[model samples]
Target: MSMSLSTLGALIDTDHMLRACCNNPKCRHYAKLDLEYLAVKLGRDHSSMRDDLVPKLKCSKCKSKNISLILSAKSTEGLGHT
Candidate 1:
């Protein structure tokens, strides 16, 4: 069976951060930000928040609407042990 894609709420659980990347092929710049802050930046109700963010989100370099969001740092690879 095919797994369904995760929604914005699923990506941000009011704790972990998310990675925002430009969808433009020529400009693949990205930035890591707090999920709660991102939600605030987008404004409006939580419903359809993902859709709302798309139009408002623009790449700093290319200024394109093609933006992608994904989980940040899935692995503990470079982090020093406590």
Candidate 2:
């Protein structure tokens, strides 16, 4: 199912994949984040808020704090199916 950036609880409820994309123009790295893990780690209430997790994200490749959140369909390989 198609979705947008919402609460982590909503994402978990919908079983969508949460991806963090590097905002750096040169380093557009993308990575999948575990929603369940995040919910446990960040707490259900904290992670359930809108855009609350974006400010804490960092690009692994470029080590930049400029990150954006995107929702993709859940997949076995963690990449959205075509």
Alpha carbon deviation, residue 82, candidate 1 (Å): 6.4
Highest TM-score, which number?
Answer: 2
Candidate 1 per-residue lDDT over residues 18-58, each given as its tens digit: 56799887889997745566557654244333465567667
Off by over 4 Å in 1: 1-13, 34-36, 43-49, 73-82
Residue pairs whose backbone atoms clash in candidate 2: none
Relative to the true structure, how large is the alpha-carbon lDDT of every model? Answer: 0.59, 0.73
What's model 1's overall lDDT?
0.59
TM-scores for every candidate against the unseen true structure = 0.54, 0.68
Report the lDDT of model 2 for residue 33.
81
Indicate which candidate wins on lDDT: 2
